[model samples]
Target: MSLRTALVAHVVSSSFYLARARILLSPAGDNWLRGRQRHFEQGGVPMRRAFAASVALLSLALFTLVIVASSAQARSERTQATTITLSGWSAGKDEDDLLQSVVNTFNSTHSTIHVDYSVINGDYSTAMTARFAAHNPPDVFYVDSSVAPSWIKQGVLQPLNTYIKKSKYDTTKFYPGLLSAFKVGKTIYGFPKDWSPLATEINSAMFAKAGISTPPRTWAQLTADAKKLASSGAVPGGKPICLPPDWARMLAFVFQNKGSLASVQSPAVTAAVNYYVGLLKQGLAATPTQLGVGWPGEALGKEKAAIIFEGNWLLPYMKSTFPTVHYGVAPMVKGKVNGNLGFTVSYSLAKDSKNKQAAWTLLSWLTGKKGMTLWMSKGLALPSRSDVKAIGGRKPFLAAGPFAHGWGFPNFSTTITVMNNDLQAVINGSMTTAQMLADVSKSLKG
Candidate 1:
């Protein structure tokens, strides 16, 4: 073959090969090389890849900023001056003011913490249960003495034993009887914030009109005077002065009768109930419901009743609402048992609370003399602290009158239940005192 023909054929073949290669690989190859060059310029990232990387970096920075802001907000919450909500039952103006003063004082003293107080209002038990179920419970709440035991059993309250131990307070600083009320098993669920002596507040003028000089101390004397009061009709409201057939008081009477409502489940409680029923039948005392829709306090306050068995807390209320009334306080009429029935309230810490330390601090301050002073000033509660009494004794209340140093029956929640449930049923003629004893014994068994 001629050299020219061969060269032409070779060139055509080479051209054909180059054309085929370009058709098959040019677009992808060009893109890959351009990407590689861009990557080298951008620290080995392809153009598309660099764009994706830039978007990722921006997204990460935004996410980091969001996280930082959230953390900052959380930190602010931990140190904010806004209040930690405190939930409690509704008290009248005087009581509210006293509690507020304590809270305000604490807030002013401690710049880091503020307590926002709120009243749970009526049906406190039901409201608390609902709130607990919602997992939005109040940071602090007032627990009643009678109900604290049941709540502890149900695990609704956190044991305060650890906090109590860590506290600078000495448990012995309180009255042994009052301190014992808040103890459950081996743990203390609460601390005593206030206490009261149960006393019979009487209309001295009525007693004088009835020709009685002193308050009755024995059941027999009480019965006699009560009868005379009923017959004399010298009570201010023009109604016969009489004791209300209260189950709680009846239980106290049973206790004074040298009878155990449930402490010993014998036939004595039944006898006690029978005796109370007889008292009611004899018209010595009227049922609370029959007193013209008046509570014992109202009855006494309005002068419809000349006497009432109540706590010392009532004196302030009586003085504030019924200023001109002449009244006297005396120890509860003695029972044959020769002892007083009492109930005590205690403040406790919450186990699951986030501000446990702060809670403990508040509790410590409130239970101490400072809190006691606030409470005493309002006359809403009696101090559990003996020191507070020593600091400002008989002069606090007794200076205003002769009949101070009043006393109440000694009983805790367990005894209160017996008094209210078993003893009450017996007194109301719903059950024999024996039945009440048995029922209470059953409750105690568990």
Candidate 2:
């Protein structure tokens, strides 16, 4: 019989024995026993009856103990199973599937902790904010490097330093740049799950049609090739390159010039802006919107543009959507330095989580070497942990990690908004490069 069935039988038997003993000890039962003893004259009837009652009582006590032990075991098992909620924003179907696979692996391996994952379909920060406000935030959630500074300042996240210290988790195994994005002072708030570095995606067919034998390796070469590609009418819209005017893409140019958004008026910043503007003026490059596409990747995939700058995330999208298009990925065209923008998201624990310890176990397993290796093996994003080697197409992204810079800062959100607006004005010929820089500098200060 099953253990539960056996326990139920023991409980029932014990109750029956105890009930019989109670009846036998009653006044009526004692009088009957005396009558039997007088009639028998042997007087051994009372002694035999008393001995039988004692044995029944002992059996009842033993069954009762067994039942109690079984109940305790069931309670302990229930107590050991902890369910934790993990929330994150969905990147795409491939990334989502890969993450779910990893989570499934974690759940299967861990007996005590269970992670219930939910993907926020809309704005992740806004959704997480509402959860925090309701005092029912998830045990753990994703924190993008772009908004980490703001989230950290808001105190919605729990610092992982104590847990890291107690568990002796090797924090040094992660890429230093990616790790720094989630840190404030000496306390780390999250662990990077994965990262993507910006790189150039070129269409070999388009290059060959334009009579170009090689891809550009430097900004000057890129401009020269763009000119030839545009003049040759290799692409349908006659645009040689499509570059998004957003700060994420522009930041690479700024950093390569040894400039920073923090110092918008620096000579390096001005040069970077002017160079991009010049390309637009010469009709060698067009923004993705101007090319009538949603993003640079789409522009390239649709053959609306010959060259574009994008990250590793584009690879899967292109392969699935535009499989026939032949393309090659190269490191970002060189400037003063071999600079590329890195985008990363980390798994952060909620400060108010009641199951903080359980949540940390899930977080550690997800970002641990084995988990990261499994996740990265799909080639969706490069592994953040140094101990986990990059496989397949992820190697280039990993190689660029050491030199890449993450896009996280206290004022990064504000800077991105202001810079994008001001740069768009410059590209439209409504504002001069100097004017754009001065305006951005003034806005940043305010």
- Model number with the top TM-score: 2
Q: What are the C-alpha RMSDs, in order, of all predicted structures?
A: 16.9, 7.3
- Candidate 2 root-mean-square deviation in Å: 7.3
lDDT of each: 0.63, 0.83
Predicted candidate 1 versus true structure: per-residue lDDT over 1-446, tens digit per residue: 55455435534443454454454357985686567557657764465676665446534444444565577677886677545666777667767777888888998887777888788878987898787666667666777666676666667666767776777567666665566556766677776777665566788888898888988877678778877887887674434444554554555555656665336565555565566566556766555566674566667777777767766667666767888888787777775555444555666665556776777777777878877777777445666776765222223322211212212223444544564655446556687656666666665555
**TM-scores of the models, in the given order?**
0.68, 0.82
Q: How close is candidate 1 to the true structure, as a TM-score?
A: 0.68
lDDT of 2 at 201: 81
lDDT of 2 by residue, 1-446 (tens): 65456546656654564575576578986787577555555547776675565456556556576676688777887688899998898877788888888889998898788888889889777888898888899998999998898888889999999999999998988888788889988999999999988887888999998898887889989998998888787887648888777778887888888988678788999898888778877888888888899999999899888888888888878988999999888778889987777799999999989999999999998899988988977677788887888766766567677777877666666767877888898888888888888867776564
Give, for candidate 2, the lowest lDDT window spanning 10 residues. Answer: 12-21
Cα distance off (Å), candidate 2, residue 154: 0.9
Give the Å shift of residue 424 in candidate 1. 7.5
